[model samples]
Structures are given as structure tokens and as C-alpha cells.
Target: MTPDQATPLLDRVNLPSDLKGFSDTELRQIADELRHETISTVAETGGHLGAGLGVVELTVALHAVFNTPRDRLIWDVSHQCYPHKILTGRRPRAKTLRKGGGLSGFTKRSESPYDPFGAAHSSTSISAALGFAVARDLGASPEHGLGDVIAVIGDGAISAGMAYEGLNNAGHLKKRMIVILNDNEMSIAPPTGAMSSYLSRLYAGAPFQEFKAAAKGAVSLLPEPFQEGARRAKELVKSVTVGGTLFEELGFSYIGPIDGHDMEQLLNVLRTVKARADGPVLIHAITRKGKGYAPAEQAKDKGHATAKFDPATGEQKKAPSNAPSYTRVFADYLIREAEADPLITAVTAAMPSGTGLNLFAERFPDRTFDVGIAEQHGVTFCAGMAAGGLKPFCALYSTFLQRGYDQVVHDVAIQRLPVRFAIDRAGLVGADGPTHAGSFDIAFLANLPDFVVMAAADEAELAHMVATAASIDDRPSAFRFPRGEGVGVEMPERGTPLEIGKGRIVREGSRVAILSFGARLSECLRAAENLAARGITPTIADARFAKPLDQNLIRDLATNHEALITIEEGAVGGFGSHVAQFLSDEGLLDTGLKFRSMVFPDTFIDHDSPASMYAAAAMNAPDIEAKVLKVLDIASLAAERRA
Candidate 1:
């Protein structure tokens, strides 16, 4: 049967309030419908599918039992919020998920009153929820006056250092709050580290009555009959395991290993928790990623993220790209470098596939280290490896690398360790929006002393930069590349290391010179072509290194050309800022050279197609052509504007 027919009970419910009057049997039907609806919607729109499906029953139970909007429920990472969105008055707009001007794939505070806090990154919900709980007690007035705050964090997210910090603080404060650990036994990749093993042991035994009591958290708080089971479970945990559980030691009422997908159990548990619970409580609800849909359940990653696909067959409708992605290019090149050098090791903060380190892992398993969701630990660990006379490539997304800034400074730069950082997804990534954008890495990393930073213009440039980063052994170094397909440049058999601080001129012209950093090199050429149509031939140079400045090349362009423009796919304080600083210091601006620096605007750009996003940033080819024309004083009486 089709999803629409299966969702008869769901058809009547436009909001969470609609589920209030329904019986337990009817509520179960609504949950089933919600699952099918979530699957169908994701198949059409193409986004985070499995996460939402996994939480369908849990979402229904929460919204049905507890008062949301007033209660303030926060989903960690929020990729699982699709079902929550559907039941919370966003069902009509659900089909537009992740498209331009559509509902966000993750939760956003600005989007709805239901979403009290905004989140896209992992493991932030517990802290935010605790803040709301405190604010509620202090009589803080919000859109919806803060009631009971609930943070539903995934098992993978809970492994992060921030989550433990939140748990520690929440337990110490003893503020009434709820933290639901959605243990699906999988993050984007399979679960890792000690936390995963600990969670597994929580339900491994036949002591359900005792386990239930220990898991229920705060035995004293539960109604009279439930206390016997709770006390025994607490004791059972204390007897064989670490004293009174790690969570109990933190002063929280620990409950569960409960079946998250079971509708009756979810309803009973949520209702009881809402009624009872005096201090901070943790509900451990064991779930399966991609719970209902057979295709998603069977596939790897449980169909974590997908393109628009057929709901019937679960076949994604994606067009084949002509060029390899920068991620793949980085992986292939890193593998080649590792083959030659045994000291080359890799580390990732729980993102092996996302950062292309999985390929490196397959070739050299012992050398690879997936350090769970702890970026700070990963950075320092890599620093230690470097200090021990090993070449460690710490591969992490540019946005995620911000978490390890302190380690980057103290452990790597301060000590002058040769730790190579492979920063992926640099620049304005489409769809995932500003929260995941890699706009600040260039600005943040380039300013540090004893650091070498490079931005790749294309796939070929990426390979060269990787080789260059590998060759740099005395200091910390990083290279960044954007998401999605490369510019179809020819693949080198193997990369040759580039000069330390040099840049090459791409096209030689006398009137004006266009200097670009990163993938904006293509846009610079396009701008140059447009200028040529108006009898203006411009010189183009690639600013390979953001740090070293390539002072000779900058001086040559400034000395020879009447006008100079620097462009980069980064924020204000990045490549352009450095170039402008050098020019100002050297009195290059006083030479009456028409100088302009193009960077992303001071405001955050929203989610859209990559081409559209660049247009919003005013860093596209047309924007570049316009900048040159305005600087050259040719825009005033435009001599037939050329494309």
C-alpha cells in the first residue's frame, strides 16, 4: 500500500495538539503513518532520511505526552527533526525540505516557535536544554515560557566532550531536566570508543527488572510500585560495574535501554517521566537507525543522506558527475603519499567517510584513528604523534576544526609540531547553510604563527597542496578545498611538492591584474574574458598560499598593472585581507593602482545552489566583472555591458 493510504489517522492531525484526544491504539496508528510520511517526504525532497524514521514513534510519544513549544524540546544535531517538524504545523511545507527558500533540514529557532534553540552541529542539545531549564525556574519570559526542557541526543553525539561537560554541569546544578540518549548503535559511521561499549552492556544481560530500575533514574522520584524495580536495578549496576554507574555518579536519575520504537512503552515512559522526575534525568531509549523502511534499514549508513529517490525501490535519482569530487581527489592523493612514507598516519573526529579518511583507513588500518566525536582530543592526539616523529594528517571538515582551535595553538603551533590538517568543505557549502559553512578556517588558521595555509584552485591544485603539506615537516600546515565536484582538471600520476611561498601567474595581461585564491580562479578567468570583450585584457594570477603572501608575485602585479583585484572564496579576514595588508604596508596603494578586494559580505549567506550562493556573496564571475569595471571607472558610461 502507498504511504498516503497508510496514513489515514495522520490525515486528521495537523498539529501535536490533535493527538491529545486520541487513544493509545489510535496513537500507534498515527506513529505508523508518521513513519511512512517521513519516508515518502524524504524520498521526494532528498535529505536526512534514516534519522527521522528511527525517531517516528519517539516523536509521537513525546509530542503526545508532553507539552511542546511550552516544554522546549531540543534535538541534538537535529537531522532527526523531520518527524517532529511534520507534526508541528510544518507538514504542508515538508516537501520543500533543503531546497532554496524551504524548510531547513535541521531545526532552526527562527523557523518556528516549536524549535526553541537552533542546531546543526552535534552534541549541543544537552547544554542548551539545561540553560532553558534554569531560565524556566528563574521566571524568564520567552516566546513559549520555558517548561520542562528535553534534549534528545544521539549515541554518537553523546560521545563528544561537550555532551559530558553538559552532563557534569547539569548533574551538579540538579535542575529538573530531561536528556534522552537515542542509542541507535550507529552515528553516520558505526559507533566507536568506550561509550558505545558501555551502552551495549546496559542491555546485554537478563536482569531486565534490575536494569529497568537502574535505567529509570532517580528511584525515589518514581511512583510507589516502580521503586522496587528501580532500587534493584541501581544495586545490580553498582555490584558488578563501576560504582552506581557513571551517570549516577554525576547525580542524575538514570533510566533505560527501553525500546524507543515501541509505542506503548514510549507513551508509558514519557508520561511517567513528565509526571515524576525532580532532578536531572537521563532516559536511554535504544533504537535502530532506519527503523521502518526496508531499503533504508538494509543499506549502509541506513540511508543516512540521500538524493531524491524512488520511494518504492529506494533508488536515488542522481546525475553522474563528469569530474571527481575534491574529497575523492584528496583521499587518492593522500593514499599515494602514505605509500611512499610509512610515518604518514591519519586521524578523524568520527568523520571517516565525510573527510575521505575511510579510503586511507582501508589501505592502512593501523595508521588510521577515528577519535569518536571529540575534535579537541583528535587535534592534541595528532600533535602528540607529530612530536613522536610521525607525520599525522588530521582530516576534519573546516567548520568542525573550529572546535580544536586551542589545541591547534597550544599543542601544534606553540610547540612547532609538524601536524598536517586536511580541511575539507571550505567556503560556502550549499543546502546545509551557514551553520555548516567553512568560511572562517582561512581567517582563523592563517593568523597563527608557524603555520602554512594553502587553498586549492582545482582538483590538480588540491593534489599539489597535499604534497606540499606532506613535505612541510618543521611547522603546522593546512590545505582547504570546497565540497562537491572539482573543475575536471587532468589527474597527475603523482603530485610533486610546490615551492614554500610562491604563486604562478595564469594569464599575462598589462591593463589590469586579477589575483584569485582557491576555486575562485575559474571565476577570475571568466571575469577576465568578460573584460576582454570590452577591449580590456586583464592579467590573472593564482594566490596559492594565503600565508607566505607570494610577495614577489603581488609586487610584480602591483608594479605592472594599472588596476589590481584580489578575490577569494572566504570571509573578510582571509586571503584578500592579507593581500590588502601587504599592499598597504608596501605603499602599493599609493601608486594610484585601482585596487579592490572581493570577499564574502559581513553577513551570513543562506542555503541555496552553489552558483546562487556565490551570487548572494557577490563573488561570482559577473560580480567580479562588475568590480573590475567599477574600479577602472568604466561602469559609469558602460560601453555595452558584456557577459
Candidate 2:
């Protein structure tokens, strides 16, 4: 079953338990085939291709040498788990990766027994592996084997503070675990900081080659009595020779910067380390991202994620859309704002293209800042810029913005710095699923004191929100918008800052009032039209600010209309919760006023189209119409009983 053997061993393997029977040579052949399969699958699916390809040999070597389901192999971020998934009974599902109702892009515990822990967020693998290790020690008896725990993390993930915290704890506890540092000198963007430089030196030195040569030479001359002593001497000699001083200081026995793509090298090193290592160990493997695909290898971003592409030429097909995306709209607006206002600055946490800040960066290079995957730093950096009298727009995805919540509360909100947070992907992101969905930002940002939160109903409103954020120089403010294209409404040539708490009436009607929040306004309007045909005319209002609640308009709507329905594209404790609280506080509920909040449900929503997800959550047109009917029934019953 060696990687070179043409037996299709990979196709036969349905589980990690299946690999237990294969010889080391056979395992090597499977690794090669696995790499081929991973490359082909990613070409079709268009996902985190490079990271997975780089770890194919390492993944195969790990499963072959270790009992996976029992041993617990945790991958950081799980972007590199395609090969791991292929080897662990999920090869057939690989083609459907990231699609609706298909295989997950990242590792998931529920998806397979071999995936003991799930991960989509970065810098969590080491801590998760350590937890498993500690649990195994406490749960297992002396007779039962408490299997090995391994965490394969990237060099980029190490830059996060959580990884260091895990490493520090593991070192102090002297846990029996292995931490594989897969150094490819990239993480979406190029690696940064002093740590990245140190790793570069280690890779350049090729310390593994020198250490192996010295150990073989010494072992050849050792007598029988001194053989045990000689082996210990060899480990000491190797440890010192490899410049593992940093890891050794942290209480980990560090091993090689071995070639990660080399199947034999990876297997041999992994086997040697697995058998001989005591306490915590760090095995550094150097790999090239997009190893097999030359086009991806040469691309600036390594073809990190693409649309459906040609496997032969690696050329991505253009997706047809009726209107420009909200991201592009924001990017164009920001550039225009920067052109007029010299104080305007842009910042992103390693996602220039995703947040649409790349255009701003190109147009105004000095004004743009990419702080790597360090969201906390990016927030504070923006705060600092604000303090210096610069209007800094911190462009970040809503889910990733969660990482900087504390900073938002402490640095920006508390001090009342005017840092404009342009929250992109602020609702149910299509394919990225729960970990990437921007469902909680509304609630989180609204709760923070001195923070003004706004949600855009359309691209035109988004332009206005941007202008509003820029004009407000006295306090911290944020505006959130969805992932895809805006509704085909004509945008204003220049934006005018709207009053903070004021909302506008889109359509005036009599029986029921629908107070819409954010991009969900369009759906509310559609529902209103549907209700109109049924002789139930509804009032539609776009409540721009989620925080302020438009108290005047809401109270008027509650008093005048038969029923009030609030709608937003966020989770339970967001806009809906705030409206519920407001109604309760205002004593409107005591008067037996009918009310219902339409929002994303309590459970985590999966990867699907925006329309499908809204329908699933009962936030679509039909669902809204049904809710209106129910409310009207309640009102009718109350009126009849009163009469």
C-alpha cells in the first residue's frame, strides 16, 4: 500500500481502523494517492487547497503511525484536513466539499469518529488536544492504553495568544503530546513577527540532516553495556545540535524541519519521534503550499479559494449576478471618501479581498493596514488612529469581529473613540456555515455602551451608513451589511449622513406595521405586498439603528396598528431581543399588544444559499405572511371578545 504502489489502497480505506493492517511501505503509497485525490477534489470544490495539499504526507504518516480515533489528532483551523478526511472514511464526499448538504470544508467531530474535535476558527487545536490528553489520563486505567494526542498546527496560528497560552500550559504540566508545526511560511497572507523569522532560520539551517548524521555515526561505535547510555547521549547530542533550545526552554523536546512533502522522510521521522519522545514534543516540518498544482503555486494568494475552476488550466469561471456585491459597493464608497477626506484610513485583519479593502489598499497604500489574523490588534490599532484624529474604518467580517469584541468594549467604546467598524458579511454567509456566519454582531455591538450600531437595508442605505460613520467624529460607530449583491436600487451619487436614531417609512398602510431591520427589509416588503393582496394592508418601516430602537416610531406603530412585527437578520439576542425588551420596558405588553420577532433561530445554521437559510429560519416572504395572519387572528379574536 505504499504511496507509489498502484493498488488504490486509499479507495479501500474507509476508516483509520482500516489503516492498522497496512505495512509502512503501503502507507507511503496511500499518501501519494491521497495527495492526488485532495488536489483533484479541491479543484472542483474550490476551497482551502494549498494548506491541505501541503499536509498530505504528514496526514498519512500520522494516521499510519497513530491510532487516530483512539489517539485524538486535532488540526488547527482544520483547513488542512482534506487529506485527513480522505483517509478517514470520507473520500467519496470530498467532491461535494463546502456545498449545501454535502461534506464539511473543515474537520467535524460529528462527521467522523476520527475527528475527535471540530475546528474552523484558528489557534484552538493545541488547547483542544491538551484537553483530550488530560481527559485520557483521568478516564483511563493503568491496564488501558491512553492513546497519544497530536496537534498539527500551522506557524501562522502560533502568532495568536491562545496558542501560546496552550503551549505554556502544556510545557508546565509536562503533558505527553506531540505538536507538529507545519511551517509553509504562509497563512492566507505571508507569516509575520519575530517568531516567523526564527522559524525561517531553522528551516534554512537544515538541522535535521546534521543531527541524523551525528547520531548514526555515534551509534555505530557503541558497545553492548554502553548502548543504552549511547542512545541517551545521542538524544542529548541531537537536541543540542537541532537548536531546539526555544522549545526545550518551553519544556518541549523539539524535532526536525523535515520535508513535509517527502513521504519516506515524513514517515521515518514521525515513527522515530512517536517511539522515542517523552513528555511534550514539537516536530517542525517544512512544506510548500499548492505543492502539486503549478498555477496555484505561482498565484499571489496560492489560489486560496476559487469559484468552480477548470482542473486542466486552473481558470476560474465568472459567476453571474444581477447587481454589484455589497462589498464592492463599500469598497468604492470608501475610496471615494478617502479621495475627499485626507483623514480616512482603512484596516483589515488579514482579509483584504474578503472585506473589499483591497481596492482601498491599492488606491491609498499608505492609508491601508493589514494586521495579519490579529483582530484584537487591528481594533486597538484603529482606536489609536482615531485618537490621533484619523477617521479609520476597520473593515472586518462580522464573525471574525467577534475576536475583537473585548477590544471594542474596552478600547473603542469605553474611551468613545471614533473608529468606524465596517462589518462585512454581517448576516448568514452562504457556504462558510456557522463558524463564519455574521449572526451575533448586532447583539454584541448594541450591548456595548457608547457604541452606535447601524444595519443597511440596501446598497443605497449602506452608502448613507458609511457617510454617517465618517461624519460622526465624537463617538465609536459600526455599520453591518450582508455578503452578496445589493437589491438593484439606484444608489445616490454622494452620501448624506442620516440622523442617528431616525427611521423612514417605506410604505404606509393601516392594519399591521412591519418594522424591518437591516437587509431583511426587502423580504418584509415582499411579505407586505403578499398581505396586501389578501386585504391586509401593512405598514413597512426601515429601522436603521438596531441600538436606538426608534422609540417614537415603534411606540406610534404599536399604538396605531392592530399588530407589530419586527424583523432582522441576526440571532436571538440581537435586534429581536432588543425590541422585546423595549416592548416589555414600555409596558406595551401589559396592554395585551400583539407582537412577534422574526430572526435567525437559536441553533447554528449550516452552509446554504441566503434565500434557503432565511426560508429555513421562517424569515422569508411566506413565513412573514403567515405570521401576519396569526397576529391578525389574535387581534380579531380580542376585538370580537371585547364587543
Candidate 3:
């Protein structure tokens, strides 16, 4: 297929099985077309554009070679699955990417049969692939047949300990699995650590020839009687000389620092490895993050994520009268605080730009640390900093923080270390979907002893929360804020620390009380306004702290109002669950007080706009209003027989 023909060919291929009929040359043409589609789609939807662009050729090569659906393909972090999605039956819906009821932004098993294993968190693909490989082996035998298991991971993802753990296990088992290391030298930001350095050395031609020569020399050195012994000895020497080479030691037949973008090289290498690989194989392919687009390639963070832009100019379309994003606001405040206090040190898990710590890093370069995808290390590292008398701000995404939960509980909370967690993306992240949603952090962190969890109602509150976290020195504290621009509110020059375990009434009313937490406060306010129009004044309170529940305020609200509701931008175990637990403990539930909790439904919400997702989850104004009216018996009374 030619370029024009390739477009129509791709348009017709909505499933991987459909591509089976196409020739390899035709498939390559389809890849080019897919890249074009992905770039155009992302230009409209505005997501992880560069990564997807980088993986287009790889995606085509993998699907063409492997029998997908039968052969499990797990994409680590899954930010680069746009091409895969396009090839696997979601092509028509590409334009609706990240919108409500549209295709997912990440690999989703429910989205397509070809997406055997889903992932959003980094470094999980290899482990997941190993699990599927094990399952397939267990189901099959030497007489039976088993399908291939491929894990397409990134170089940045390999920085995480979990990927190493998977690699170690896969190597130890000698599983017939393939791990494609997509090395772009980035993970939202430039990767760090000894592993990253090692990979960099491999990229720089440290010992490839030397190791091969040594192995050949060792084989020649063996006596006739001790040939087997010499073979084992050679393996041991090769492992050692590689500077504690973990992958080879673990037993993986490692191959290539090959060019990922070079189609011919990638295909030949992949085919060769697939044909002769008995044990596990790790293919290290180096490619640019934003391979095709010059603007994205030239971007500081490789256009990790973006707003909708023009395809011709690669310029983001400006919004009408845009307010400061929550991230920008946080970044600005962090910088201001760092400037005021020299002891204020900021840390992020390879997300300086994402967590709004880029400004802080810029202003206080000496104090900023990008720990790379190691969230567990980032948390404990921050704890160590705090113990050493430095104020450490551990900024991380709420979803990514899940990776460091144990560390947060064990290292920080257990020790009562004053490590301030600046948790960004604390709610349903638009486009990124459930895996990236900041749903469980509140519930997970709030439950821990010696931990203070606060969720900002808006950007102004986020500033105050940051100050509060900085001010609190007795125990570990975290402040979570949602993604996207702040609701245009008056700015505060300096953040004032609020009294702990306290909440404020935003609007005083009777009959019904709406307890709003995090970014859902605006929705609650809107709901309150709607209720007021119906002659039902609803009390609105911003319960800032998810942990250390404002018992006094909650009890008062329950006592005063005939009906009570709790609203939050999280799943079941978050603010609503805490409120239920509190009410149950206080014997408030038995008082015949009508109550309802408005939280994210117990399901994995797909990629969409934040507003649309909230609305779908019934956490929006109209839904909240409807629920509040129902709880107040207003809806029921309106339906009753007239006297």
C-alpha cells in the first residue's frame, strides 16, 4: 500500500486479525499511516503524543510478528499504546480518544481482546507478561502448545525496582518470554539512578565486544574433560565482568542496544531473537521519545503530555481567558516557599514537570532531587532528609504514590517523619483513565497512623495546604490536588496554615448538608445553588482533611441538617468511607438521619474529560443535586398523592 492507500487500509483495519492478511511491506506502510493518525488524533485530543509517536513502528512490527489476542502483549505504563489501539480495532474511535464513552488512553483489556494485559503504572508490564506466560505454560505442556508473551517496557520504566524484580524472576525461571526495552532515556522526565547510568553505559558501548571476546577466550581456555565446567565458569566470569550484570545473572539472554526506529534492523533483530530464544530475552532498543514531530522532539520533556495543538505548526490552541493550572499554582507556591526557606528541599519520582516541581527545581537546583520512577525510594529518601533536619517536599502523582504506599507507612508515618507529600493528580485524571486516577490515595494514606492527609478544594486551598504541610513538623503530612486549571478564584499571596482537624462552612443552610472534599467543591457549590432554587437551602462545607476527620463539624452538620451527603473525587474507600466509619463509630447512623455518600462508582472509569468523568461517576453538580434531593425526601414528596 502506498501512503494514500495506507490511510484507507488502516481505516478498514479495526482489529489485529484484520492486519494478518496484509504483507510485511504493506504493514510497514500501515505503520507510517498509523503514526500520522496518532499524531493527528493526539493533536486533537492532546495526550501522551510523543511516546505513542515513538512506538508506532514497534507496534506494527510486534503485531505483524506476534499472534496478538493469543499471544499476550503487555505494554508498560501503556502511554505508548495509541498505535496498538489503532491497529487493534479502535481506529474509528481514535478521534474520540480520552473523551467520555470513547477509546481508552491506555491499554485496556476490556477495550480490545488484543490488549491482553492492561497497565498504566510504569514497570508493571514485564511482571504481568511473566504472570500470563506462567499461566500459559501451566495450561500447556510439551505435547500441547503455548502462545508467546511479550512485554514492551521503556528504559525509564526499567529504573523502577519492580521491573528488575520481574526481570529477576523471569530470568530465574528461564521462561520463554520476550521483553522489549523501549529506551527513550525518559520517564516523563530524564531518568536517574545507578541502573539508568548502567543502561547509559550499555548505550555508550561499554563492554559488548569485550564481554563477547572474553566469553570466546574462556571457552578456548577449557580443558577437554572440564568443558561443561568451563562453560559455567565462562558464564560466571561474563556476569562478573559486566559489573554486577543483573539481567544475565538472573539468566536472561540479553540482546541489542539496537536502533528502535530503524525498521529493518528492529525487524531482523526481533525475528532472529524470536527464532533462537530458548530462555527469556531482553531486547534493548534505543529510540527518541518524540521520533517524528520536530517540535515534540525539541521539547524539554519530549512533549510527555500536551494540550490539543495544530498539526501543521505543533502549537497548542489557547483557551479563552485561561486561569493558572493547579500544577502551575503548586509550582509557583513551592518556588516561593523554597525561596523563603533554604531548608525546603523538593523531590519527585521522575516527575519534576508533572508534579509541578520544575519551578522549585529551577529556583533551588541544589535542593531538588528527581529520584526517577522510584517512588518507594523517593518517599524514604524524603524521610531520611527530614530526619537529617531538612524540610523535604516529596511531590508525586496520586496514582504513582500507590507504588510507595508501604514506604509512606513504614518509613515516614511509622517514624513520624515530617515529609510533606505534595500529591498531584488527586482525582479522575482526564484522558489517562482509572489507572492514572488519584482514587485510592486518600483512603490508603488517610488510614495510616501518624499520617495527616489533606485534599485541596481549589488552587487557593492547595496553596494553603502546601503551607500547612510545610508548617507541620510533628508527623508526615500529604496534600492532594486534582489535575487541570484552577476554578478562577481570588489569589492568595501567602498561604496561611489552617487549624488541623477542622473544616469550614462555605455556605450556611438548613434541611440538607453537602460535605465536599478536594476538587469536587465547585460541583457541590453548584449543586447547593440548584437546591436553593428549589427552596431547599443546602449547607456546603469543604472538608479539607480526609484524615483526622473534622468530627466537630461533621457532628454539627449531621445534628443540624435533616439530610447529609458526602462528595469526593475518589472511589469507595476515600472521604465517603471515612465519613461512614466516623458516623458509625459515633452512633450517628442509628439516629434516623438520612445520609448518602457521593463518590466514584466501584468500577474502572475509562479515559474522558475530567468533567465528563465526574458526571459519569455521579460526582457532578446535577447528579449531586439529584442525590441530595432524593436523600432529603423532596423527590419522594413531589411524587406523593395530593391531599
Q: What lDDT score belongs to each candidate, Candidate 1 first?
A: 0.88, 0.82, 0.81
Score residue 394 of candidate 1 by CA lDDT: 96
**Per-residue accuracy of model 2 over 94-196 as CA lDDT, tens digit each:** 8888888888888887788788888888889889988878887888533436889999999888877778889889999888899998988988777767678
Order the numbered candidates by TM-score, best leading: 1, 2, 3
Give the least accurate 10-residue stretch of model 1, judged by summed lDDT: 634-643
RMSD of 3: 4.7
TM-score for each of the candidates: 0.97, 0.90, 0.89
- Which of the two, 2 or 3, has more lDDT? 2
lDDT of 1 by residue, 189-291 (tens): 8879999898877677655634554544567766688778767766665646621278888878777667898898888778888888888988889889999
Clashing pairs in 1: 210-233, 213-230, 215-254, 215-255, 215-256, 216-255, 217-253, 217-254, 218-253
Give candidate 3 regions above 4 Å deviation.
Answer: 1-28, 140-145, 205-245, 584-592, 636-643
Predicted model with the maximum TM-score? 1
TM-score of 3: 0.89
Off by over 4 Å in 1: 1-6, 206-217, 232-238, 242-244, 636-643
TM-score of 1: 0.97
**RMSD to the hidden true structure, all candidates:** 1.9, 4.8, 4.7
Tens-digit lDDT track for model 3 on 467-583?
888889999999999888889999899888888889999999998899988888998888778667778889999999888889999999998888889988887888888898889
